[model samples]
Target: MTRPTPAPKPSAPTGTSAAHVPLRWVGPLRISGNVAVTETEVPLATYESPLWPSVNRGAQISRTVDAGIRTTLVDERMTRSVLVEADTAETAYAAARAVHDRLDELRAITRATSRFAELLAVRHEITGPLLFLRFEFSTGDASGHNMATLAADALLGHLLAQVPGIRYGSISANYCTDKKATAINGILGRGKNVTAEILIPEAVVAARLHTTAARIARLNVHKNLVGTLLAGGIRSANAHYANMLLAFYLATGQDAANIVEGSQGITLAEDRDGDLYFSCTLPNLIVGTVGNGKGLDFVQENLTALGCREDRPVGDNARRLAVLAAATVLCGELSLLAAQTNPGELMKAHTRLERLTGARDAR
Candidate 1:
């Protein structure tokens, strides 16, 4: 696989509104790296800072909740169209599927590496005689937006070279739906559908967060569910899953814009025996162990500190990173939910954290 380009730099530093202060290390949330779970406060300090070199600080509320990560690598699809000059749209779609089935039969002859893209399904759109072939692949680990594209190219070449009566209309068809939200991807899922769940006890919610599970459930029902439905939202119905995802992405080397899909998540809660079973599912989490700015000094150091810089099976590392990201999202989600349980807590925490950090830096 080709190396992914570097991640962009963090936006211009803010005066007091900056979400993070340079050299501020946020939490050893889990028993990560050399830090124990008890050392939840600033376990991994920002690496290679000029001023706050020795001191370590954590993403305050982020350190409280526990998160668990799980990764899934399913087929992400893209389109390679074939020109089927047929009498009608019905015939055009049939023509594309027939070619796909033929290719499926000859898989034994066409495939070289197991990594060679396998066609999962064939979908088509009919514009009179023009037929668009949207092919799906069971791409592993690496978000195969580009992988599927390359594989589609090769597959199209093979079809044209070998298959008779398979005329080509185009290869660069957008049906594969790269980097955008589509209903198909939402249902089938694209990239790593990483889910992070935490069962917060009633006692902990009451004592630490000043909230009740019943209230949490009610809030989600009205705000996330009904509110979003009323507003005509698509797919997701959650509270600020993107906040944590974006913060983590900026720290790590990832395509920040992918938060578009990453943010398309569902935050669900159940009052399980008085405890809140909170989970966030980011179906379109596109992250990797390698690629992007993984080569950067700061990003590399952060990954190492997060214990994500390790050798594992081919897709294991990337999946691990996905889970970690999901876990982080859960942490922030839980914390913010707790804060909102009591009015003004969110801004108050901001006042204490951001304003104080800004004040400290100015000093």
Candidate 2:
């Protein structure tokens, strides 16, 4: 029998300040708590599936694009090796050129346009002995992990050929997984599943807010929801919303499967002023805006509604959705906290407002 190593203790948040506001709401819900959200998009082309050759390859390519987009984001900073997508091969090439022109750096490009249109984009940075490469590309549709890997591998091969002396190293490909693992490890005894911690100073204000302002340490609400579903349990909590969004992603040519691990890790805390903060960090979000199922009329319409353009990179849209999901989860956590602490307060307030409106309308 192997004994598990104890989880490392979590370090207190550095640079936390005392609240100056008498009745301030902090964390994800509070206006005082500073939260940062950023997103990126890449485009991909449809390609042949390895599993089935007879079926249209567009679906496979689309999936790859989604995975590639997720890979680029989820980290604190963007690196080289970006991805791009477009409707035609010409457009894909043009997009790559445009990105290169903007950055004014030499980059290697690879085309996977047999079944669809696509391009692989990457940027390089050197930090002393480490050569950091940030890549963004379009995966077309479905879960484009394979396509992204192919593109990145091809580009890296080309880069290696050009720069003979650059020693490339292997880093974690998925940002959400790596970050969530680190976060979870900090809270739980290395591998404890259900762990809890309090975010001091930030926890105070999070306690008072009606919105999703609580800071969470190691709760992946999405994963929990999926686990419940797999175990034949009813859907509850913000996990339901995550499921809906994931369905949309899958049906609309994004990577639906990643929803399982993508929805992991969250931050909830309170401040000195009884305010609450809540934030969700998903490091495994795989999404795309073009290729595969995107060609479907309804999917295209949804993309339009979401303000995604064919000329733009799909990763950009993925980032937007990720941020929206995080915000939504934050709000949901706040609702839970409010209801748990002050039952029926929101309902009574709603009834009071409805009565006041009715009286005014009668006049």
Candidate 3:
């Protein structure tokens, strides 16, 4: 009541102050994948205290298996969409055709923009006098947001100069569907599309997860598949991919907002002879080895620790990072789903862990 101390007179800004979040290294998880084959611990920065132990439990299970968490890189690309207005619908259609036919020329423009950004494909949508061109590129090492944008800018400039009867509408037209949840990103692919799989023995599932394989499989069907369908989820079917993705993204110096689309994934489970076959497929795992936000001291340390700072091929580091990120998701998703299979298990764990840490409103 004696006046709040005037909020300490509002300290002066020092350019930018760091927002320090709780960081922990979870898991010496064994991940054997197309991109990575190593047992590594991942750094996760999140406010959720329970996630550390939850992922750690899944990591423990991974150690018991021979193959461990097997990750596969399905596809990888970053897209940038540019909108242009034509004089008429026919002109827009013609311009779209011209762009598609001139892929080589566009590639040259993209190459001129950035050495790492290579033009992969150009797809277009025409609506009346509007033309939306989605340019896809393979951006090496970096997440490719800036690289794609720079290439798109150059391509757009060339199109305006050469293509007739079209003017710039906007650099982005949502057709690229960067962060927003959309069906196209899942179907066509964006970022690093990866799938992580693990086959747990019957005894391991019973002893570690404390649930039968049949129960976890049934839960995946009812909760992940059907439940997501009922919830009108655009292109995602998972219990809590966002939680792990957010933590991993923060720790690895990724564009955390990319988790919006990055979390759009599928969790598949099957009961095979009392064993469990669990997999998490993330189609939009947007991460990078070298890019913005990675220059920070802590980020550099984390990346180096994760073996992403190696002098491998141009795109290997980023792909390796993506694989690890997917494996991390599998660990967290598997643990959370196992917890949810039993009534009150999730809440009890949350309450106990949060209360132990003195977090407000433990429940």
Candidate 4:
């Protein structure tokens, strides 16, 4: 994957002298990396009810209760999409065709097949094996975590059954990282669960580019960037940002625990237009509607406000929020950089704001 161009140096702030400090400069400026800025919005589309034959009303009620808590407890059902990538565009197309054919044949099977109510779409292509497939499945009122797993497992089983010479070693399932095994052990004892894997060259490209971008951004840090900022401050900022976003995710019927892995965001900044040009990315964001949890009083309201209903077009609102978060952090960092070079002005402004607002502390 090709790396993004290096950022230009930022011009020194003008007009305002260090004497005209701002109250906001008192707190440590938190900045996210480039990986946190890129986002793609997806709309939740209609799917054939996979729950009807699989779940009884009583079980469904239990699922509703679980969904209310932003948990992923529910009956297992299948929902899947296939992605294929290769060295060349032609090769990739050929692989996709093969996978698509295989999926169709699987749908024809007795216990393994069912027609998808929603047609699948190719989300985006980054580089290498970096392709994303979003299956808009309706998991009733709870998060469809189990459903996604079942679908992936069944699909893998079919693929293995039909394709010879492919071993488990060739496949690596991940929502966030390989270390999920450790996190799962800490949270839910060793329980075997279903997982999803999509093969896409674009995914590989995206990952490589993202990693490179992060390295480039870190290199831009200088002596002035330290002292004022704590050691490992960037990581701390990311963690703080993740936690804040998790609160919103929980409040909105998202499986907040997934944030433990999916909460990662990347940021990249360069000098542009006399300001910083920045980008961020977040992946593995699993959200659901028409689940048990979404029926909660506040969740339903928030989803409505966000236009996230079962019938609406897949939206990019979530991605946009992530980008906004990156921008906020970049602004904070710039403010902090200025403050470190000239603290007296910032201190005075912070003091004034505290007195005026009756605030007791200033970071």
- Which candidate achieves the best lDDT against the true structure? 3
Question: For candidate 3, lDDT tens digit of each residue in 11-32?
Answer: 3232211356778898899999
Once superposed on the true structure, which residue ranges of model 3 sit more than 4 Å away at CA?
1-18, 359-363
- List the candidate 1 regions with Cα displacement exceeding 4 Å: 1-24, 31-87, 103-121, 125-130, 138-141, 160-172
TM-scores of all candidate predictions against the true structure: 0.75, 0.38, 0.94, 0.39
Model 3 has a clash total of 0
lDDT of 2: 0.36
| Residue pairs in clash, model 1 | 26-58, 26-59, 78-176, 79-176, 83-169
Cα error, residue 56 of model 4, in Å, equals 44
The list of candidate 2 runs beyond 4 A from truth reads: 1-146, 152-252, 310-315, 340-363
lDDT of each: 0.59, 0.36, 0.91, 0.33
Root-mean-square deviation (CA) per prediction? 7.6, 21.2, 4.8, 21.5
Q: What TM-score does prediction 3 earn?
A: 0.94
Q: For candidate 2, lDDT tens digit of each residue in 1-363?
A: 999999995532321111111111112211111212222221112111111111112122112222211111233211123222234444444444444464323323445322321443444433344444555444432235545546556555555454434434553333213223233222221111111122323333333333233322223333344454476542122333343334334434555554454444433344324333233344434555554556755456545644554454434554444343333333434343344344575466546656764576479
- Order the candidates by TM-score, highest first: 3, 1, 4, 2
Candidate 1's TM-score: 0.75
Report the C-alpha lDDT of model 1 over 251-310, residue by residue, as the tens digit: 676777777777887888788888888777777777765654567666666667666676
lDDT of 2 at 60: 22
Candidate 4 segments exceeding 4 Å error: 1-144, 160-239, 314-363
